[model samples]
Target: MAAKTVTIESKDYVFNTLKEAQNYYDAIVKELYNAKLTLTTGQDFEDLKWIYSTYCHYTKQNLDKLSNSDITGFKGISTVREKGGQYIPTECCAIIFSDSSSNCTEEEFFTDKALKEIAIKQNPR
Candidate 1:
């Protein structure tokens, strides 16, 4: 048996010359590289969502109770909105990255204790 070779050609090729085809191929390669560069992992995505929600809640509460100057002085704050909404703070990142200065704030610790006490009184536990 003899080896056979076949060649295929498009009569109406969009790119008339090999250089044009190469240019198109190069453009597609660049686009693919750029797209890959922008991808993020699932865990990173979820953490971002949680950070956004927490920041939104804190910013809303803090801003409502303080003046603009006072609000700006605090770090790691951004615009706050209902759980699902569109709004971005002009001057802050939508996430906070910090450690607790205390294990829990004085007010929150007492409030949590009070709630636990009430729960215990309601049902013996």
Candidate 2:
């Protein structure tokens, strides 16, 4: 089968697979780091990078091998939904953390101080 292809956001290049896209993204991240152009997302860019790296590793390898640390590392870095002010983290433990399909309340998602606390909690020790 042909490798799946995807276009990266905010860029024009196409990647054959998720791994290829990630490699390209990693290269850009490295270049940004070298140029001191990294922007802080959630906590620091470095922390988010580590979390994403861990996520990618578990996804590529056996997900059954994922440890508690791996899930906790990224579970708290929430992203705001495009349509609402609600915060949504991609994964939490074995759950794909999203409230889109449920009758979740706005309070269910972190915001303001709660979001900040999540970021702080996810930060590396």
Candidate 3:
């Protein structure tokens, strides 16, 4: 099958292979890390760092060790909702990549480190 294309924010990432996808994902994580460092602190900075950390934790294993399923599963959209029912999307940190086929909310995506860790366990090397 042809590779799937996932867009996080306005950037477009095309994955022709598992490795390709993971590389893109890793690159994005690194980019987020760098971006976080440039920010002045507060919500935006913390949010970016959080995503970078979470991505690292999720993709800590060698990229070669990941399977096709692992790559495909980690596709998501970046957005979060405020307490007043407002949806907010931040480019500095929010990465919308997930493995579960179910829909995930912004709250679960950003604040659910446990879920990410579980996903790592589910797709062991």
Candidate 4:
């Protein structure tokens, strides 16, 4: 198949054709390739992968916190209205991904910690 032959223009650079744009990017990558991996041995690569994985997980959580309806926004904790019309905190552990957008019990998480917080919230002294 023939490649697109249209010219591409960005801020200050104009690429005559798709191949030219690709070659331009390829050249930039080649120029920086050695510098990017010069100090990275197998162990260094593994460490970077580990750190990147953690970074992705951490950022996803933080981003979730910024949203009102994200599970991590409340750390998978929620509330349920009981038969008596009273409400109770519920923990979903790692199952739910987005916040239910309902009220979550105050600072209640893990069972023990959550129970304490629930008690404190219910009967503050």
Candidate 5:
């Protein structure tokens, strides 16, 4: 079957399947990381590179397993309508994160004084 073509914000692309869309998502993330590294310093670049590489490797490894059904999970349709006898999916917004985990304690969330004290104690420079 021929791939479906879609346009986003005036950009056009042909997606063979949902896997292609997933690959596009991963590519965008990698490119964003690369751009950030171009604007950052030694420690920040190294840390971001390590994080981006890990994510990219995992995404590429699982790319083949993605399908059309998975695409629905990535975006939510606000309304479905029949136009010219064809049903179209109208996306309201994309789902960016699935995990709702919080990494910081209530003290960290409420105040940065504790964090600053810890940093000063550790560095002392």
Candidate 6:
């Protein structure tokens, strides 16, 4: 399908799919790490690249497997909706974010094996 041109909040941004928008965002991150964000360099820069690249590599693959419809997370409803804020797509807010839908504050998604690992760490055999 052809990507539609769109403008929001006095800014013209066009992205056909979530993947396209993500690639654009990732490019910006690369600019920040290697160039624009001047402060950290060498290992810190490499580490940041590694961390975000790994996240992008795997998630992008997973995202490719899903239909665009499924990616429209929460579809038009959000409890913590911010007024007058740049609307972040579901793709942008997937991981590293907490919301009413996927609240992982307590690490509730950890498996039973993780509990055992924590116990062993606290009380080693």
Winner by lDDT: 3
Candidate 4 regions off by >4 Å?
1-10, 37-125
C-alpha displacement of 19 in model 2, angstroms? Answer: 1.6
- lDDT by residue (tens digit), candidate 1, 1-87: 222211111222233333443344334334433443321334333332333333334335443322221111112222333334865
lDDT of 1 at 80: 33
Clashes of each: 0, 0, 3, 3, 0, 0
Give lDDT per model, in order. 0.28, 0.35, 0.38, 0.33, 0.31, 0.30
Candidate 1 TM-score, true structure as reference: 0.20
For candidate 4, the lDDT comes to 0.33
Best prediction by TM-score? 2
lDDT of 2 by residue, 55-92 (tens): 44533543332332222222222233433675553311
Cα-based TM-score, every candidate = 0.20, 0.27, 0.23, 0.24, 0.22, 0.24
Model 6, residue 16: what's the lDDT? Answer: 48
Give the lDDT of residue 4 in candidate 5. Answer: 34
Candidate 4 lDDT score at position 87:
71
Inter-residue clash pairs, candidate 6? none
Off by over 4 Å in 6: 1-10, 36-125
Which of the predicted structures, 4 or 5, would earn the higher lDDT when compared with the native? 4
Distance (Å) between predicted and true CA of 84, model 2? 34
Model 5: lDDT equals 0.31
Give the per-residue Cα lDDT of candidate 1 at 61. 41
